[model samples]
Target: MSDIATFARVKRPVVSTWRRRHPDFPAAVSANSGRPLFDGAQVTDWLIATGLGNAAPQELRSELALFGIIALRNRFTPWQLVETLGSLLCLRRLDGRPLADDGANASPTSPPDAEADEALWSALLRRAERIDAEDDFVLRELRAIDATAAPLARLAEDLVESAYDERGAYEWLLAARSRLGLDSLAADAVTPELRSLLTQLTDLGVRLERGESLTLADPHVRVGDLLAALLDDAEDRDRVTVLAADPDDRLTRITRRRFLLAGVSELDLDVQTGSDLEERFADPYLAGPDGPAPSSD
Candidate 1:
């Protein structure tokens, strides 16, 4: 009942009222130390059907229910879940198929099954190889969670379904980093104030259009927070070339996928996994009066 109240974004007393007044409310599925535990899915369904709670949107409900299950399972750490879900969402965007039909797509809408855990993992691994042939983004993360990949896949699918796209899903997960106990793992966290400043400084709306694109560089691309902020204002994301580098390999891979989901073509992205102190790319852009592109487009 408390879970239901949380799901509905209502008071605990309201949940009791619901149980007393609404005979159709889902019954307790089991007892957990004398407290009745109702099915999360059932409660979500009831809330959606009866139009009783703030969890009105189907996507929000999916997200909530998935989180509940993740908490119950307590198998993967917050970082593991975030990274693994990112790979699953990336696979879904690239493959255009349900993950479970093959292995670990979230399938929030389907009945739980355990048919193709091994096969699905293998297939997803192969797909990850093909998609990230260089082992840049999704490959290592997928392999890390390979032993129990199926459950993670299902959660990933729910994420995508909730956000209605891979980019939104991945970003949503990242936004919940602090909530997911990932503050320790996360780097250069983008607070609202800093994000606002970054976005204001990165006002590329006109430049992105005038030059047909821009090559935005972030030396500290931990999870691509700053770059993603710039990309958000870009009118032509595909044309924009991103040049970034980070010392952290894992964070770099995450930034790579974040860029991919932002609509920057893989061919156009020039992100690396080390500092660019030596200037690798040819004739690097210099900021000065004598520098090229006086318009700064």
Candidate 2:
């Protein structure tokens, strides 16, 4: 954590230029203890000012949702808001533009235009998946909000946005269905063609986990989605414990926690609530070796 002085030394110019135009920038970024509170508006402003882009995925999702709410109020299409946010985030990530230039990049010899959109979309999807994979503050906020009802639906869409690739799209659908009570219409949202697309994406994840080549064309459902959906069915509910073989290993990796839930009965529907699973993930103590393991997830 760099002191305010240090941040000013490096980030001062960017902030200064931002303040010159905006004029109402906070005196200094608010912090508790020492870590700065990176709110959505500040983050978006920083990205726009520095041209650095939305590096923080969860935070970006929150910010984009805020943008969507404004759009909804203005009578703009919700889908259009999502597309715009996604495109902007993708472009920023690919360009790695600095905040100083007001986000204008004129270099023509950059990554080919054909490749830029794909790279951008891939970046946004990866960010969204990572947010889903890790239950962060934004995730909790999204879960607390109603997806199919009221003001939160737009936020839910933003959280579940960035389904650029088939796998990402599939995972998001299942996530929405499980968390947002969109289950009845989930299958409808996921067409056969989309399933095929997701199948391929799932295959990629499996291959990566196995440290194998990722050339397969078969569509594979995401392991996370399958697990999440399985846990939601009442019959599939089972008592299982999560054990991390290495106590000191990093918990950030998607593969490290390898959850092993124990309720796979042949004829029973193992059901569990999405919130229950989420609660288990949110527990920091559960990351410790000696903590009592939750039998669900």
Looking at model 2, which ten-residue stretch has the lowest summed lDDT?
213-222
Clashing residue pairs in candidate 1 (N, C-alpha, C atoms within 3 angstroms) = 99-105, 104-153, 106-154, 106-157
Q: Tell me how far the alpha carbon of residue 96 in candidate 2 is from the true structure, in angstroms, after superposition.
A: 2.0
Cα lDDT of model 1 by residue, 117-139, tens digit = 66777888888888778676788
* Per-model TM-score versus the true fold: 0.82, 0.24
TM-score of 1: 0.82
Which candidate has the highest lDDT of all?
1
Across 193-235, the per-residue lDDT of candidate 2 in tens digits comes to 5446544534434333444321111012122233333222222
lDDT of 1 at 125: 86
TM-score, candidate 2, is 0.24
